[model samples]
Target: MESPGRYRYRPANTLYAASHDWFSPYLSRPVRELLDAGPHARSLLRSPRNVDVCILFTDIRGFTDLSRTIGSDRLFRTVDACIGRQIRIIEHYDGYVDNFTGDGLMAVFEGPDMTDSACRCALEVVSRALPAVRYGEAALAPIGAGLHRGDVAMGTLGCESRLTHTAIGDTVNRAARLTGFARGRDVVISERIRRGLSAETAARFAPVQADRRRTDIDAIAPIYRSRCG
Candidate 1:
C-alpha cells in the first residue's frame, strides 16, 4: 500500500517509461494530448496559458491537533483514506488531482463550466470524504476548501532530471489563500467564481468579507461561503 499522505498519479494502463513521472495519470485526456505532441510541448509547462479553470484546495481542519491525538499509524491511515476518496470524487466531477498538500490536496477543473463543476466537487468532498472515515472515536467532520476560477499559467517546473507539472499565477495563489478563511465544513469561493455561476447556483452561497489586508490580491472584492448540507 502507498504510504500515508503521499499522493502520486497512477494511470490505468502500464506505465510508460518516458513520461512516467512527468505526467499525472489523472490528467484529463485533453491535457494528455497536449503533452504527447512532442518535445516542444514541454515548453508549455513553463509558459503560462490563459485558460479557464477552477482551482480547488481542500485541507483538513485542525490537522495538527488531530495528528498529535491520533498515533502516526492511525493518522496516516486516516489521511490516506480521506485523500484517496477525495481523488475519486474529483475524477467523478471531471477534475484531476494536481498535488497533495500534507493532509489536504489540490485539484483542477477545466471545461466550459469549470467553476460550477469545482463547486459541486468541493461540496461532494465535504459530504462524502469527511464522513467516509473515522479514527477511533473521532470522525473527519470538517474539511475546508477554497475555489476560484480564472486564467492560470499551467506548466512544469524542474531541472533536466526532474519535472513537476503544476499551475501558478495569481489565480492559483488566490484559491490557495482563500482556504485560510474557510472554517468547519465551509467551501469558500472567490468573486471570479461567483461571476461565472448562474443565478440558481449563485443563490447557494452567502457573501462574507475576507480579510485580505495581508495578501497581494485585491481585498475589496467579497469572498463567498456555503455550508455543506
Candidate 2:
C-alpha cells in the first residue's frame, strides 16, 4: 500500500489508464464496464445495428418568413420543438434521427425491416407535424419530405471535435436533394424507394425522378398522401 514509483491495476478497484480516463470506481457497474472498454464503448452502447437502405429528410416550408415574424429567439424555440417531436417519432418507429440540418431533419432506418419502418415513420411524422402547424406551434413554414432507398455505408465518423454519427454515400445526399425539391406538404419518393414500399405505400407517390439526373426544374414528379392513420 506504500509503494512508490509504481502503479497497480485491480480490475475491481483500479481501472487501466488505457481506458481513455473514463473508467472510475465512482461510476455504476454498467457505466464502468462501458468506460473500461474505451474506444469501443460506442459500439457496446449502440442502440441499433447498421443497415444499408434509405434515408429520409424533411424541411419546414415557409420558415424564412416565419423566422422574420417571430425573431430568432422564438423562432429557435419553435424549430427545437419541431425537430424534437420529429426525433421522437423517428425513434418510436425504431429508426434513428441522424442529424438536424437547420430547418430540416435527416433520419435513417436500418435492418431487414428498414424500408417499411422508414416509410411509416416518415409518413407518420409528417402527419403529426400538421397539428403543430395549426397551433402555429412550430412557426413552421411548410414541410417537404423525401425518401430514397439504395446501398449506402452507414457508421460513426471522426474523432473528438469532428465526431459525427451518420450515414454516407450518394443515396444520402440524393435523399436530401430530393427532399429539397418537394413543395409544401408533399413527400417526394425516389424511384428505387418507391419500389421498396408496399403497393399501398407505393400507390401514395408519383414519379419524381426517372433518373437521379438534375434537371433545370429538377423535374421531380409529384406524390400525394393523406395523413397517415
The candidate that wins on lDDT is 1
Model 2 over residues 1-229: C-alpha lDDT tens digits? 3212111112323333344465442332233444344465566434333446678999988877777777677777777778878888887877666677798878877667778778878877777864563334434766778888876765456777765545778788778877766777777776667667788776666543344465622455443333332
RMSD of 1: 6.8
Candidate 1: the clashing residue pairs are 45-155, 45-156
Worst 10 residues of 1 by lDDT: 1-10
Which pairs of residues collide in model 2?
Answer: 61-142, 62-141, 62-142, 208-221
Residue 48 miss distance in model 1 (angstroms): 5.3
TM-score of model 1 vs. true structure = 0.81
Candidate 1 achieves a global lDDT of 0.77
